[model samples]
Target: MTSRQRSAPASILQGVEALLRPLAVFRADLHRNPELSGQERRTAERLARWLGHAGCEVFTGVGGHGVVARLRNGEGPLVLLRAELDALPVREETGLSYASTVTAARPDGRVVPVAHACGHDIHMTCLAGTAELLAANRASWRGTVLLVGQPAEETLTGAAAMLDDGLYQRFGVPDVALAQHVAPLPAGVVAHAPPGEPLTAAGAELRIVIRGRGGHGGMPHLAVDPVVVAASVVLRLRAMAVQERRPGEHVVVTVGALHAGERANVIPDSAVLEAIVRAPSLAAVDRVVEVARRVVEDECLAARCPDPPEFTVVTRVPAGISDPVAAARVRRAHLAVFGAGRVVEVPQGQASEDFPLFGADGRVPTVYWYVGSVPPAVWDRAPGAGPLEKLHSLPAAHSPKFSPDPVATLRAGITALAAGALAWLGTGPLGNGEIMSFGSLP
Candidate 1:
């Protein structure tokens, strides 16, 4: 590493620290005014406005509220830093002063509460801080920086939506793509999975609708009992991984939702199940899908369903793999900034992310890492405590109650992202007047 690179961490921290307060307030504002997927009109405009003031050439409404801001420095490779712009359809339970009380109307026309249950507010704030640092320290690193504000990530469609609308074609592909997700780890700590290890599993949304005859509650034989069939389907789906998957293969089948009858004494005509299938590989995901289809059909048939069961593949997203080389560089950068004790190893995650689509099919080298969001006091008090008393004490992402320590979490995020970006942008063929290539991929 260059002497300049060795000293870059301190420089980055100094720059980010100055912007921490505004960034925290920005995050709180975002948390207060959460918007749902593809409906991030206000969020996108707010991000664009900030980036524009930071000297970035901003483009709004790229792919239905996706924003792209470019800050070009002379003669170097391009790097993309991405952040999600949408929020989830979850009501706030955190009870914080900035907690979202905002409700948005879904496409189905039902109004529902919205909140940043997944910490996109923090992600966006960090992106803003990074933009500020990079813009201020342009002379320290030479390259084009593209800050992407993506929408609909909660639905796993935003990244693809942006790409389909010509994300790369319009602004050009990036040599390196960087993004960070907030985890439940203690504030100020950053984590990365081992090199070559999978970051997040590929995901497929499975929707099953089981059809049966409806009748009065007293006539048990007449009703066909679609609910029983639905329960059977759920149990079999769980067994799929154990019975079908290889010894070392990883898989998860979660039945997230089920809906059927509304009345207490009446049997419903059909039951619907919404499940998520996750696996380390696309083939495994495909296998799970196939098995799930057969399972639903066979179970319904065994129950003497009046009609064929309905199956729909709602959405499919590819697995996320960290580029070994890029990841190693980012890891080293984290170690430099936070020290060895604060930089920890992260296990492969079961949760799915559409961030991979930004570098779809490995078209761009990407490093997606985690930033700790749990308050230090809480994390410190977890030791010697039971799992339920400790881990369960803090709310996990996706819960309406999930809340990150705003200031510390924001600082940690800005550090990891800006440090990692500088690590890659500071070195390599790009800075030496050569282009970046994934070698075998392109």
Candidate 2:
């Protein structure tokens, strides 16, 4: 068969020509109205209105800004589809024609313009389109499809909040859960792995606050400056690279933010610290968290000052792993859509995702895939994002100049989700037992 004919599942391509325009609009509309994490009130309203019209029984106000909709056709496995509903705090750097028109006051008392730098725009749009397609043809499938629009992924609080609100309990969970993210990879291409390999992710954030007494800058002997204690903390954190921890385990600790002083001469009373840690396993993460705390405690005691309670070992993001069996189904769907050559095992990333909280029961398996969204110009220009600047850097996703090939990205996401859903439902002639199997391929 020709390459043109070797496209996604027929269920996706059948009405592709018709979905182009509206899908484009959906992407643009979302791009113009990016909302911050945990504060996705307006974003929830838009999703609610759309899902309501899509012939699904929609529910709103779930887990802060979350929205859940249910479409029941016949008795089959319940599938959960999730899309995050949050935006980055970046001021638009990418001067695209259709940039963000939404701006809100941030928690830190700053009013920053919001943009869909993380491609959540396409995610929401894809969920909407997928729901519409599947719901419109309810007769072709069985079982209940649960579509969830989660909030605050940027803060890594959405999924946790949703579950805290009884998402799985009241919602009756699912046999398999699926979600996809856009990558800075080549546009329109999809990357997903099968069971027994890498998939999705989970991790945490560390906030360390070292408090000390502030006095005259000149009198170093008198003032128990917190900055000095903070300095030791920084060095210890930096030293994690050389310091031996677990055997053959990768635990990354990055001190992203440090603040504690005012004026050149005056010392501050406290220093606040924030860092992100990424680990493939829960045990490794716990080990690192304990070590970090021990370091902070030791430093505080050595400084001869009372240890501040503000020095915390808080966790923001949870480690999300792609279920072995569920991942295989996603892999088959991606292969069918992007073809074998285009489908690949996504590289293990240090970046963290909170999708793990949804499938905590181990019943509703969630597999989050990546779709390449590298700006066409950048993709052609540089060899890659390189060592210094990355996808979520100031000049990448959060930049005003970071314009995505929205159509290309959206098409791949929609096709992936739609094809994934169809294959999940055991629709058409893909073979029911052969479609999604556990452990290994038959």
Candidate 3:
């Protein structure tokens, strides 16, 4: 995040500063002390504490590490705001003095370092500040506001966990849902897609194996090298797009990982390809799988392998659709708060978010938006920093070097998340309307 001296209306800057100033500490705190999915006890506690102090009823540990708060006034429309509290397995390397020093053991007995490389620290901070700002200034609207501190967003389970915990029925279903993500786009710009473009994309994983015979390295013809077969399989996978599908479709099939042989002299018996399939729509995702399966089989047959290799598709994420009406309200709020130039339009994201679970029934309209995080200075400095790291490299989101500009990122998230909730819930001034509270008074 970068800092800029924009000569704008004092009210807009004041609103953002008031919300973000206290919230920046939360970001630094969360960054210095990260927590992994399903293990956000401390994170949840922090959110609850802040929300509790803000005059809203806060409940801790709703689902795993979920925290809920609720505020009410003369009712008109109920709004739900979600904040993710999970961190990634990134070893902090950004020389930021406040980088994560937290570590924990996983179910598999492996201890991993945690960090907020994806800007969720900013998200969680924004959640608290946004809640506080809206709660404090609740005199301007009429309705109930539900603020949720969700867990497991990295693994795409937080939203589902809360709903499964009877969140909707326990208190009441919200008339609108609002969510946002900090993007790699230029800082201070709020990028939003229209009603239909989903902020939470649907995705699945695939385990594709190619098998062959082992032979001496000296004689090429004597052995059935899966390496060769796998190579052709890769080529075929790329070709499928050019040969079978129409150009410009929203589809993505990527092999994230691969594993095989060990020795220089021996021929490996098998090769494994772990892949991910993504699309804005389920039908497109299905088509991606279909193409992948066909390409694998055809390529293996062409390579004269012993038999068709084993292939499996694992469900990873459901497409996250931002409620259309909820999104519009948010967009309008952003414009009102930041003006037109700062509010940009969003396209369907190739990245996936799991917030779609809210719309699993396809009845509720969910609106998701993107907030730019890259500092204009840093971006202007690192011209090579394209949209994101190229496709798949294990070191991506988990890389220790994955640091984003914080000040700008934090402000963008705080403003967007705060304004999004305010518009959805119709929040009023500090002493006037309903506030952003979570759970039943606990």
The best candidate by lDDT is 1
* TM-score against native, each model: 0.90, 0.86, 0.77
**Candidate 2 lDDT over residue span 271-304, tens digit each:** 7878766666766766677777888888887887
List the candidate numbers ranked by TM-score, top first. 1, 2, 3
lDDT values for all models: 0.84, 0.72, 0.70
The CA root-mean-square deviation of candidate 2, after full C-alpha superposition on the true structure, stands at 5.2
Q: Give the top-scoring candidate (TM-score).
A: 1
Candidate 1: regions farther than 4 A off: 1-9, 383-393, 427-442
Better of 1 and 3 by TM-score: 1
Q: Please, what are the lDDT tens digits per residue for candidate 1 over residues 1-442?
A: 6776656557756877789888888888888999999899999988999999999999988878999999998878788999999998898899899889999898757698999999999999999998999898876778899999999888888888889999999999898898999988778877777678877889999888999999998897978989889999999999986787777888899998788997978989999898999988878999989988999999998999989999999889988888888887777777767766677665687889888887776778888888888888877676534323455567889998898998889888998888877776764211211111111110
Best to worst by lDDT, what's the order? 1, 2, 3
Our tally of clashes for model 3 stands at 31
Candidate 3, residues 118-181: lDDT per residue as tens digits?
A: 7777777777776666665555546777888889887666877888898888868777777777
